[model samples]
Target: MSLIILASLVFLLMPIFLLLYIRSYNRHKKNHFLEKLNMQQKFESEMLQTRVEVQDQTMQSIATELHDNVGQLLSLTTLTLNSVNLNDAEKAKKKIDNSLSLVNKSIKELRELAKLLHGEQLVENGIGHAIHQEINWLNKTGAYELKINNQLLDVQVTSPDKDLIILRLLQEIINNIIKHAQAKHIQIDSYLEKNALHLRVRDNGVGFDPNEIKVKKSGMGLNSIYKRIEMINGKLALNSAPGEGTSISIEIPYP
Candidate 1:
């Protein structure tokens, strides 16, 4: 009779133990699910923020180009027109011809600026062309010698979000070079390798110690670049030294 009673107790406790185990497992599963959902939401938020920052930077660039390049050209044309004297036909003809030429140059510049104005449309065309457009704009500055090796140009694979992020990354890198790096030569290489897309930008600029930058938590938009790369499930390798230069390489899984 005692043995029977002990067996009954064991049987009763078995269900209770199983119920407790299941409840604990269910709670853990719920917590895991919530964590994944939160990470997804955070990624989406970062992507949106990056998009806005890139557009704002583009607009600022446009304003500067207009004021410095096209605007200056137009202002010169105005001054030339104002100086024209209708009293002297020969002199007036010469000034008019010069003004016409200036106006034509301004129109050409405006057309180029128009291309820049449609920043989103650039990515829509394709990442290759978008990249070419960016390099072209930077080349206009004539500040550095650029060596470009773009293997993805003719290879048509569309990843719009990644493209924008990559473009912005390039912009930030370039901005850093302009602001801090006093180097003169830049090389950019992009290609596909082992089902992954790779982009590398190197510059012969005054580079600082990466460890120092990490400790200081400043310069070259490093924090922003790392965050964006994380959001896209990409990896970044930065190489730099104090008088040597800086190189940034990014690798991402492709479409």
Candidate 2:
């Protein structure tokens, strides 16, 4: 009788244990689904923010180019035309020629500005070409000695969202250098290896302590870069010192 009772108990406990396990498994599945949904929402939010920042940066570049470049050229052309001595045919012809040259230069600048206006489209072309376009614009500034080895120009694979974020990250880094680095040389290298995309930027700028920046939550847009890299599951290694300059390396999974 005791043996029969023990077997009966064992059979009853088995169902309870199975029921508990099913309940626990279902709970875990629900939690995992919710966690995944939250992550998807966060990634979408970051992408939206990245899009806005890219647009804003493009607009700012356009405004600056218009004011500092096209506007100045047009103004000089106006002045030249105004000073033309129509009474002296030779002098009048010379001033008119100069004015025409200025107008042509202004047109060229406007065309370049138009290219910048299509910032989103540039990224759509290919991240490699987008990067080259950015470097060209920076080169035009003649602010730094640039050594570029961008091997992505012919790369066929792309991730549109990642491309935009990467471009903005580069822009932010260059902006930080322009505003605070006070360094004269900048080097950019980008390539693909071992199923990953790598980007490295080194500047001979007045560097700072990364630890101090983290503690103080100070400038250089380091925090922003970190957050974006995390969003894309990328890794960044930043090295810097007071007089040693700054170098940043980033690696991300590719398409």
Candidate 3:
């Protein structure tokens, strides 16, 4: 009777043991596949970023050539044309004046292109200084009031990946506030907390439902924000509602 009882117990346990074993095996397989997928995706993202950087460098080179070579040639050609001696002296003076005006205009355009192409000011002075300068410039331009809290002002952020990520994140936030927020006031605060960099960008503007907006066809922008944060193993929070304000908080881990 005891032998028969033991046999029944083993029979009852066999299916559960098999099920647990299969579950573990499948979980391991899923995890392995997911790791491979993540690796492939990271490779693709890096490649795309490299391509974009190359394209940007090429564009800057073209812009420089246009301003330096083409613009200088135009100015020199105008001067040479003006130096020409003509029998109609009065008409020649008028034409020379016109050419001089054209040259001056070209110089102005070249100066602007130079500003855009050469001086980023972001790399030289560091990201914090650059952000403050940009915020100051923005505030000076219109009815926009910007408040920047720089807790990490004296602390140098030398991590290239982190620096680029923060800059991109801030740029997107500022662009969103400027384009969509329609707010009179903006606030940005940053500091190091709990072994991570914390940032908040807030504005007194109308807000939308994150759920509704994130699912739309034009969801690329929102997805970009989330994906970038995810790629860096960071955390992001959004606070907003209709007729209320919007605030975005981001936290990037150290090491």
Candidate 4:
């Protein structure tokens, strides 16, 4: 009787143990599925945020160019027109000619701005052209001497989101140089190698200690660059020293 009772309990407990094991497995699978879903959602949210920030920066660039470049050109044209002596044919012709030239320049600038306004389409086009367009706009300022070697111009590879992030990253770096570097020369090189995209930017600027920036957590822009690069599984190398120039190199996997 004792042996029969013991056997019966073992049989009953086996089914219970199996039920518990199945329940635990199902719970684990459900948890894993939820975690993956959450991670995907987070990625999408970050991507959207990055897009908004890029758009905001583009708009700011547009506003600045219009006010500083195109606006000045138009204003000068207006003043020349206002001073024209219509009664004197020769003088009037000269002033009118100058005004026409200015107007034409302004028209060209407006056309460039129109292209900038389509900044989002940049990804659709390709990173190389978009970068060239940006460099052209920066050159218009005539503030810095730029040496550029962009080898990716003819290469056809697409990574839309990464391209936008890369553009924003370059813009941030340029803005930092413009605002604080007090530099006179900028060098940019971009190319593809070993299935990786590389961008290198160097500036003869009043450099700072990268270690200090990291320790103090003071380089907000730098932090953003690192964060975005990490998001894209990319890497950044920064070389800088006080009284020496700064150089930044970014490496990212290709599409």
Candidate 5:
């Protein structure tokens, strides 16, 4: 009779133990999910901050270009009008013609700048060709050694906004290299990885700490790269060390 009672008690306690185990497991899972969610939120917040900073800097750069070049040209045209005597019609006409020519040149340069700001044809062509053209410009300048490895022969990722983000991001990167890194050999590669487009920009230059993105002034550019990627729901990875080299890779999801 005692054995029967003990067996019954054990059967009752088994379900209780199972219930306790399930409750503990649920708690653990909830904590894990919460932790993951918090991390993602933090990452998003940081990315937002970076985007704001980068966009502001880009706008400032454009504003400076306009004031320094276009504004000055306009001011000179005004001064020429004010200084020249009206009695000298032919000479004034000649001066006016010269001023008009200068204005035209300034307009042409401003158009190029506008093209850059607009990200002209990023969607019509794939990112690979777009990058090829940008590097071609850099090559023509003979400022940096720019090489591209074609890996996305038939891949097409098209979006005006994404294109602008990527092109501008690289522009900032190259600008940083020109002004700071003094990089010589720069190789860029673009390919498709899994369900996304991947790009890598490698430079043989004086690289610095990736952690320094927090304190370094040039960190803004790096942060821009990251935020741009994030804006497209992409992924970015940077590898660099002082006096070594830098390789930045970005992966954009297919939209």
Candidate 6:
């Protein structure tokens, strides 16, 4: 009689226990889904911010080129034409030729600037081509000795969003080098291997202790780089020490 009572109690409680278990499971499932949605939103927000920064950087570059380079060339061309003496055929011919040369150079620079204006489109072409364009711009500065071994130029596969982020990361790195590295030699290597894309940048610059930067919690745009790398689920290895050059290696899964 006692066993029968116990069995009846168990049977009566089974539905309540099952209902509680289902409720707990559903709650956990909903929470997990919400957490994922939040992460996706955050990633999208960061991407938008990155895009804006890239565009701003491009515009700043364009403005500087127009003011410091193209502007100067055009001004020189105008001055040369104004100084021309029409009565002296030979001298006038020389001045005209000089002005023509300046004008041609100005046109060339404007053409290059036009290409830069289409920074977004450049990434669309392919990450490799985008990188090549960036390297070409850096080379034009002639401030550093650059050794480049970029193997992505012919690569047909591309991740549009990743490409843009990667380009911006490169830009930030180059900016740091220009502003603070005080180094003369820069070596960049990029390639694809074993289903991962690898980028390595080494600079012979006055390096700083990475620990110091970490302690201070700011410097060299390292924080931004780390966040972006995390956003892409990529990895970055940075090595540097006082009086020693800095080297950064990054690996990301390819599309």
Ranking by TM-score: 6, 2, 1, 4, 5, 3
Residues 1-255, candidate 4, lDDT per residue (tens digit)? 999999999999999999999999999999999999998897788788878877887788899999998899999999999999878999999999999999999999888888888887976799998789878878978999999999878879889988888888988888889888989999999999998999999999999888987665358388888887888899989999988989999999986
Instruction: Give the alpha carbon lDDT tens digit for every residue of 1-255 in model 3.
Output: 999999999999999999999999999999999999998788478546634543364355446557665567686767768676798788777767777777776776566445434324443445565455446435634668778896765656545455555656676677688778888888899887777888899989887777676555144266667777777789988888877878899999853
lDDT of 2 at 116: 88
Better of 3 and 5 by lDDT: 5
Cα TM-score per model = 0.91, 0.94, 0.56, 0.90, 0.60, 0.96
Task: For candidate 6, give the lDDT.
Answer: 0.91
Query: What value does the lDDT take at residue 156 in candidate 6?
Result: 86
For residues 92-131, write the lDDT of model 6, one tens digit per residue: 9999999999999999999999999999999999999888
lDDT of 2 by residue, 1-255 (tens): 999999999999999999999999999999999999999999899989988998898898888889988999999999999999889999999999999999999999999889988998999998998899889878878789999999999999989999999998999888988998889999999999998999999999899889887676547788899889888889988889999899999999985
By lDDT, the better pick of 5 and 6 is: 6
Q: Put down candidate 1 lDDT per residue, 124-181, tens digits, no spaces.
A: 8877887898898788889999999988889788898888888888889888998999
lDDT of each: 0.88, 0.91, 0.69, 0.88, 0.71, 0.91
* Top candidate when judged by TM-score against the true structure: 6
Q: Which residue runs of candidate 2 sit more than 4 Å off their true CA positions?
A: 214-218
In candidate 5, what are the lDDT values of residues 1-255, reduced to their tens digit?
Answer: 999999999999999999999999999999999999997787667545544544564466567668876788878877777766769998889778878887897797577556545334533576666576566556745667678886764665566456556666777777877777878899988777777877788898998888767355246367666656765788878888989988888888864
RMSD of 6: 1.4
